[model samples]
Target: MNASLKLLPLAIGAALAVLPAAYAAQDNVQTLSNFKTTGNTKPAETVPQTGTRADALRENLKAIKLPPGFKIELYAVVPEARAMTIEPSTGVVFVGTRKDRVWQVTDRTKRRVADDVVQFASSVTFKVPNAVCFSPDGVLYIVEQNRVLAFPAAQFFGEGGPDVAAAVVVPQGKLIPTQFESFNHGARYCRVGPDKKLYIALGQPWNVPPKDKLAELDKNGLAGIIRMDQNGKNREVYAHGVRNSVGLDFNPKDKSLWFTDNQVDGMGDDIPPGELNHATKAGANYGFPWYGGGHVRTEEYKDQTPPAGVVFPMVEYAAHAADLGMSFYTGKMFPEKYQGGIFDAEHGSWNRTKPIGARIMFTPVKDDGSVGETEVFAEGWLTPNGEYMGRPVDVQQLQDGSLLVSDDYAGAIYRISYAK
Candidate 1:
C-alpha cells in the first residue's frame, strides 16, 4: 500500500473525535441508509389549487395596494410556505414549509399560475424543512431543523416519484447540538452563496437565552449563521450573534450578505426595533442577548458591557413587525427604479397591541451601494379591524422578472408583476 494511504484510518479517526457526539456513526449510517432507497412508487401528495380556499385567497389580492402598473395574483397554494428557491433550468419552484413537507410548484403550460403543487420527495420524513434553496447547477438543498439534505439533478428526479434520489449533507442532530434544540425559533433560512458554498441561518432557540447558554449557543452556531461546502464539509460559522434570521439574500451588486432579524419579545409593543442587517465579512457579530435589537439594550444584559465590534442594522424597522424573508430584485420586468432593490416580507406581529406588517416593503439600493429608505410596496393584509387576512413569509423572483411571495397564514404563494 502507498505510504500516505496507510495513514487513512488514523486521519478518519482524528476527524471523528472532534465532531459533536450527536454525529454518532451509527445514527449517520442509518440516516444515509434511509436516504439511498430505490425510487418509491407512492404518489406525491398534491395540494388543491382551486375551491373555496383558493377563491378566498384570490379575493384578498384585491385588497393589496401596489404601485401603479403592478399587480398581485395567486400563484399556488403551498401550506405553511416559508422559504423558496427556483430551478434555473425548469423554472420549477420548490417551496419549504414549517411542517415536514417541501412542496414542488410547477407551471407546465408556461402560464403564470401553477398547474401542479405536490410534495417533493414525499417518502423522506423531514422535521421542519423550512429552508429550500438551489445551487447554480440546479442542485436542491433542503435545510431542516437539524439536518441538511441535497438532491442533485432535482429538477428531473423530483418528477420521477416520491423517493427522489437524495444524499445526507448534514445528518440528523448534526447541524447543531441536539440538546439545545427548542420548539420556538426553529424555522431556518439558507442560500447558496456566490462562492458556491451553502449558507444557513441558525436561530438561537429562546426569547432571550439565559446568560449561561450564550457561549454554547454561539459555539454551536445555534445563535448565528453557518456555511459549508455543498457536500456539507468544512462547516464554519459565517456570522455570530443573530437572534433569529428567517430571511437573507446576497446583494447582486457587491455580494454582501443582508438579512432580517426578529428581535426579543415581551419588551412592550413599540421598542427594540426589528433589524435589516448588512454583513460585509465573516465573523461579524450582530449583538444579541446584550443588545436586543437596533442597539436597544436587553433587560437581561443592560448592565453588562457588550462585546466590542458588534455590528448594528442598516435599517431598523418598526418594533414587532416580525420581518422574515427577503430577496434582491434582479429581474428586468420591474421599472428602472426597482432594478436592484429589496422586497422584504413582514409576517406581522403576534403579541403587539396593534398588529403591524402583513405586507411587503421595498428598499432601493443606491448607486454607491447604500440602502435607500424603505417604503411599503404592498399592504392591506391587516384589515380595518386589525385582523390578519394573510401574512407573507418569503419573496422569490421568477426568471421573467416577476416576484412570488409565500404566505404561511394564507397557505398560498402570490405572484407580483409589473407592466406599463
Candidate 2:
C-alpha cells in the first residue's frame, strides 16, 4: 500500500494540469548566447590522488551526526576550489574556479589557520568562475560568464600580484546579456546583501522547455532572483521561479534571503526535489517552470493554478540534489546544535539515475525562520553504488568557528570543525 504512496494523487493531478500552460507560453526573454562556456577548456589538472581511497572519503561521511563536541577536518587542498570568500581584514581564503582560476589562500600562521595556496587570478577565458564576494570596501566581487567583475584589496594582496589584467570593475547596472540557444541562466552565484544589495543567481535560459513563443509559458522569461545596487543601480526582481540558483545567503538572523536550487532534468528519476528558497518579498515567485516541491506542479505549469502571488519551497532536497553553496551557521564552535543551521553544498547528481548530491546538508532553523527537516551534515562523496569522489561546493564560516568546504569535484577545501 506504499508503492511510493501510490504515486501521490497522480503527482498532484499532473502538477495542477500543466500550470497555466506553463504560464501562457512564458513571455519571450531568451538571449544569453545560448549557454556555452566550457569552463577552462581543461589543462592544468592534478590533485585527485587520495590514497587508501582516502579512507573511502570517510565512509559516506559517517552519515554525519554531530552535536557532541563536533569535529571534522580535511581542510586545505585547494584544487579546483569553486565559490568561496573570506577576508575579515586578512585571514584570506579567496577561492573561485571552474578553471578560469582565482585563489589566494594565506593564513601562513595567523594561528586559527589553514591556507597557503595562491594563484590570485589568471587566464580568464570565462571558465565557470561562479562567485566570490567581499566588498566591505576591500572590494573583490566576481561572477563570470555574463560578467560582474571587481578586485582591489590592494589588487588582491599586491607586490605585483593578482592582476588578471587589472583595471577590472563592472558596476554600472551589472551587465546582463547572454542567451542565445537558451538556458544561459548565468547570473552565477553572487552576494553582498544585508541590504548592501548585490545579490544575483539568475539561471534558466533552458535546461529544457523553451522553444520560444515568448519563451513558452513565460513567467518573465527564464527563471529568477536578481537584485542589484552595489553600483549596479536599482535593478529589482528579488525572486521569481528560479531554476538554477547556485546557492545564495543572507539570513544572519532575519536578513532573510537563502537559496539553493538546481533541479529540472528530463523529469523522471523521481520528479523534482532540489530547492530551499525563502525570499519573502521584493518579487517572490519561487515556482520555476511551473511549480515544484510538495505541491509539485510543472508539466510546463500544468493548467496554471499556482499564482495567488507565487512562492513556495522552504525546504526540499533529493531529486537531483545538486544544491550548491549556502551558509548560515553563525558559529560558536558548534554544539548548541550547530547554531542556526543551514549549510548546504550537495554538488552531486549529473542528471541523475543514481548519484544524489555530493553531501553536506543541515537544515533546522526556527525561531520564526521556518525550515526544519534536513540532515546528513556530511556524507561520503558518493557511493552506496553511485561512485563519485568529491563534489561538495560552497559553505563558508570561519572567524575561527570552522567550516569551509569547496571541492570542485575534489579540488579540495574542506575544514569542518568542532573538537571537544
Candidate 3:
C-alpha cells in the first residue's frame, strides 16, 4: 500500500492525459489538486506610480518632522497599504491591503523609488489580506482573515499572469474554526522565524471575550500566537492571552520573539498602556482580559485571580496609540546608535479626545538584548488640530538600509533615508 501511494502521483498525472472519457469526468479530482486557486479572468491593474495623488502625498511630507539629516519621500502609491514583506534577493516588495488585493512594487532600474506598482496574484480572491511575510528562501506567505497561502518564488510568479502558482498552506476556514471568525480585529500577521517555523498572530474577535468563550478561545488558538511547520503542519500555540497583536519580529541577537499588542479601549484612554512584549520561551501568556495592558485590570475580569507567571510588556507605549507593525534595525546605513534598535509604527488613536501617536517610534536595544525606553523617531502625521494626515501601518527596512513606511490612510508607502 505504501509503495502504491508513492506511485500514485505519477499514475494520476498519466491518467489525466490518457484516461477514458468516464475517468476524465471526475471534476472532484482536479478540484482537489494542490495547484488549484480561485482564478479570475480580469487582467492585473497597475497603480499609477506618479500622479497628482502621489504628488499630494509627497507634499504632505513637508509637514513631517524628522531628525537631523533624514528625509522622507513617496516611494509608491499603493492603495490601502497595510502590511509589507520584501524579498531580499530581488528587492521586490509585496504589500497587502485590508481589502482583497495584494500589490507588487518593483524598482526595475535599481532606483530606490519604485518604478511600478501592480496587483499581485489577481487570480486569488484574498479576504482582508492585510499581512504578508517572506521566508529567507523567497517564498511569499499571505495571511488573510481566514486563510494562508504560500506562493513559491512569488517575486517571479507575481510578474506573470494572474494564475500565479499558489500553494495552500492553511486552507480557507481551516486556520480557525468557522464560528469564531469575525471581521473586527481580523487582520492577521505572520513571520518566518529563525527556527524556520511559521509564526502567526491570531486576534480574538472582541473587545474582551466573555468568560464563557475563554476556554474555547484558548483551545482553538485564538487570542494568541501559533507556530507551525512551513507547510502548516503540527500547529501549536506559542503564546497566549494576547488581546490583538498586529506586529511581530524576532530579535536577531538572541532570537527571541517580540510582538506589539494593541490594548483594550473605552477605559478612559490612559489606564492601560499598549505593549511591546518579549517572548523568551514557548507557552508564555501576555496579560489580556485579566489585565487590559500592563498591570491595569479590565472591568470584565477585574475580580478574578489572574494566572501566575503571566509575562508583561518589555516596553509600555501610551494608551490608545494603536501601535502596529515593527521591525528590528539590522542595516548598516543607519548610524552606530541606531543599530540593533526597533522601529514601530503607531497607526494613531481613533477614539481619543486628543489624538496621539501617528508616528514612528524607536526603541534602543542594548548589547545584552534588553530594551531601552522608546522615543518618537518621526512625527507630524497627527496635526495640532488633532487630525491624522496619514496613519503609518508598518515599517520595513530595505536592503540599502533605507526604511519603507506604509500608510493605509494615505494609501501610500514612503521611504526614509539618511545622509551624513
Cα RMSD for candidates in order: 4.8, 20.9, 5.2
Looking at model 2, residue 411 earns an lDDT score of: 68
Rank list by lDDT: 1, 3, 2
Clash count list over all predictions? 0, 44, 0
lDDT agreement with native, every candidate: 0.86, 0.64, 0.85
Task: Return the lDDT, model 1, position 242.
Answer: 92
Per-residue lDDT of candidate 2, residues 1-420 (tens digit): 333224324432332343233321231101111112223333332333245444454453455444566656555667677888887777587888755667767666755445356566432334456688875656667776555554445334332332232222332222444333233545377888877777877676666555353243243323676776654546666776777788888888788888988867777777788888888567767766666544577677678566577676788788877788888898888877768878898888777676677878899888798877888777767767887777888989888778888887756676778777
Candidate 3: residue 271 Cα off by (Å): 1.9
* Residue lDDT tens for model 3, 115-172: 9999998766678998899887777889988777677678887787676655556666
In angstroms, the error of model 2 at 80 is 24
Tens digits of per-residue lDDT, candidate 1, 198-287, equal 999999778999989888898888779999977677899999989999999999888889999999899999988999999999999999
Q: Estimate the lDDT of model 3.
A: 0.85
Cα shift from native, residue 247, model 2 (Å): 4.1
